[model samples]
Target: MLFASRPTCIKRLLVIEDDPLTAFDNEHTLKHSGYDVVATVDSGEAAVAVIASEQIDALVLDLGLAGHMSGREVARIARDRGIAVLLVTGQCPVDAEEMAVACLGKPHSAAALVSALKAVETMTCKNKTPRKVSGLTTFWRPEAA
Candidate 1:
């Protein structure tokens, strides 16, 4: 089990979604929700580039991206770099529990997004996993010792 403690409250976000409308919605929602949107990119390549250069706190990712690199790949890279992930997808991957702080399914509301992110903060910072949060599948990590 990994014991490293990353900052639980994510302030800066990188959004990776190919759909123009969804991307715009996510960017706008996150910004209005008081999260700094570092960049909104459609491809994992661009996401990776931003990850390399920016001090991003989290990645809001979509599964069906239009590029060679998949969302899973980007999530791995982000996690490796100590960035949290919040997956917003229609088809949640089987291994999402391993890669993301939470999986927020598609057709979700803004309230659900913010709530799930707050759950993330609770889990990571407080080491308390909340149960049955709406519109999200929160992940688990071993408590840091």
Candidate 2:
């Protein structure tokens, strides 16, 4: 089975999470999946700074960061900057309309993360078309963004 790979230029990602163990695990998984993680910040403030400085392709954000700024803030900034976001959090009840990023529930599988990342990449593509999976929706385009 030859699976399609995401765009090569957009391989960098940022991770914002308060838990070191989960962050490490996620980093390892993303790296194994061929993503170049730019940084791992424990707070949304730090994440904002890193995002401002680096050319991040995507963000794996945790809503409950240990700072005044939350992942929602980071996601908002990313959306404004046209950077994609993947929100990972427990059931804390976020306003879907407030978030322009993909939301993945806690304790999600690696396959789900990969799928979300791929969808985000596809959405960021130049075409901006949405792809429908077996029973899920994904924004995927073959054009460059």
Candidate 3:
């Protein structure tokens, strides 16, 4: 089924998760969900580097990555650079009103992931939200800023 997105610009996404299985799942799901996942990295440092050097339009970021650099840090960098971010985690949610467009809790469905991303896309473009899904929380962010 078709999703809500700009017809011409397939969102260029990046996936950042430390868990091998989750990372693989995210990439596969996103690819099938009509998003162009440009890269998948497992650390904050690598995520930072990819966002800096590539044309990444969004990030599917998992907090609690095993590293000195935190997922929050990468989200901030992406946010500052006008890249959309959707933070995912099972632990305590971070204070991310400015740094991310949405927060998706763990143990979610592929449909939830797609719906959450579509919600973020619509919210960013139209300032309107879609139907809320379980485990998905959204926040307002300035257009690409």
Candidate 4:
């Protein structure tokens, strides 16, 4: 008798956005896209706290967080911890392409977010190396809706 292989576990995502509405929308979209959104927080401090305590697979960070620590800093920390990070920002920083696995512009679609996450996961799984903040980056721009 042949036994079927077990399915891979869903990825756990953390959404860090200052805007309540945007955070809610992002959480909803990620959930419907099959990702397990472990936490949604409004500040960089909160994000750091959650990251330290959870088994998070990825982070959806807003560049302009309302706190002392910018999202860029948080992403760097997360990457150091071997977690993947994707930036969702209105004004993409000059170094964003170098800091994250992928950078998506603000007002992006759910499909775009999902696609970026898949690409990050694929690259991470293939490399089997510790996540480096200075690694190659993938910038995805969703078509106008």
Candidate 5:
């Protein structure tokens, strides 16, 4: 079945999780949900580097990363660059409201992940202006003077 208001652009997603199994699961879920899994990295440093260089549309980030920078730090940088982020952690962070679009607790279902992705897509689309109709003209008529 086709969606009535599907996003016009394909979303490129980056997964940043330290655990190998979790990373694999996240990648699998996103791929099946129709997002392009750009790269899955285990360290915050690597994730940050990829975010800087790649054309990523969103990020699925783990709170405790393998490297020096925590997921919160990485998310902050990604957000500054206008990339949408969803934080996944064993326990949700208190400051997630300021940094991420949403936070999912660890051991979440595939359905939950898909739902969060859709929310981010909708948020991104809202920032863009609707397409202008072609060959349309508006003439302003003066009231009788």
Candidate 6:
């Protein structure tokens, strides 16, 4: 139940970012691009809480956060719960093993962010869950040939 009118068309997204400004910018970009932002959390703990409470469709995660668990951990939790994740990280750690649909390097533009979100939406539309998104869901893994 993401969009009030067309839930099947546009899905809800959760943003896990510690920086208020970055989160706001991401929210603004996604909202303007016709996506429903369900929630924005500044920590992994809050992210876990919201994921349990809300019917979320996708997640936009930043690598580093203020809590004990980083965004990689958040992505892992989301993947285990069958939620789509779009990772935005300054550094793509080699050890990350969870799944993520989209990964944008830091200092990305609003347009790039929008495009990444659209990719997530398309994957969700096709597969209903990110885990089934044809190799795009595997975190830190190169695209499958």
Best by lDDT: 1
Per-candidate local distance difference test: 0.83, 0.74, 0.82, 0.75, 0.74, 0.73
On residues 1-145, what C-alpha lDDT tens digit does candidate 4 reach at each position?
Answer: 1212211332899999999999998899788777789999988999999999999988989988877988888999998997878888886679885567777777776666666666666556554332333322474333344
Model 5, 1-145: lDDT tens digits are 2222343343898999999998998898777767889999988899989988899988988888897888889999998998878787888777887788667777777766666666555445554322222221111122343
| Best-performing candidate as measured by TM-score | 1
What TM-score does candidate 3 reach?
A: 0.88
Backbone clash pairs in model 6 (N, Cα, C under 3 Å; residues 3+ apart or in different chains), count? 0
Q: Which residue runs does candidate 4 get wrong by more than 4 Å?
A: 1-10, 127-145
Where does the lowest 10-residue lDDT sum fall in candidate 6? 128-137
Q: Which has the better lDDT: candidate 2, or candidate 4?
A: 4
The C-alpha TM-scores of every prediction are 0.88, 0.79, 0.88, 0.79, 0.79, 0.77
Distance from true position, residue 126, model 6, in Å? 2.5
Clashing pairs in 3: none
4-67, model 3: which lDDT tens digit per residue? 4442332899999999999898889888777888998998998988987899888999987767
- lDDT of model 6 at residue 87? 86
Error of 2 at 139 (Å): 8.7
**Candidates 1 and 4 compared by lDDT, better number:** 1
Q: List the lowest-lDDT window of 10 residues for candidate 3.
A: 1-10
Q: Indicate whether candidate 2 or candidate 4 has the larger TM-score.
A: 2
Whichever of 2 and 3 has more lDDT, that candidate is 3
Model 2 agreement with the true structure over 9-51: per-residue lDDT tens digits: 4699999989999899888878878889999999989999998
RMSD score of candidate 1 (Å): 6.1
Q: Which window of 10 residues has the lowest lDDT sum in candidate 2? A: 132-141
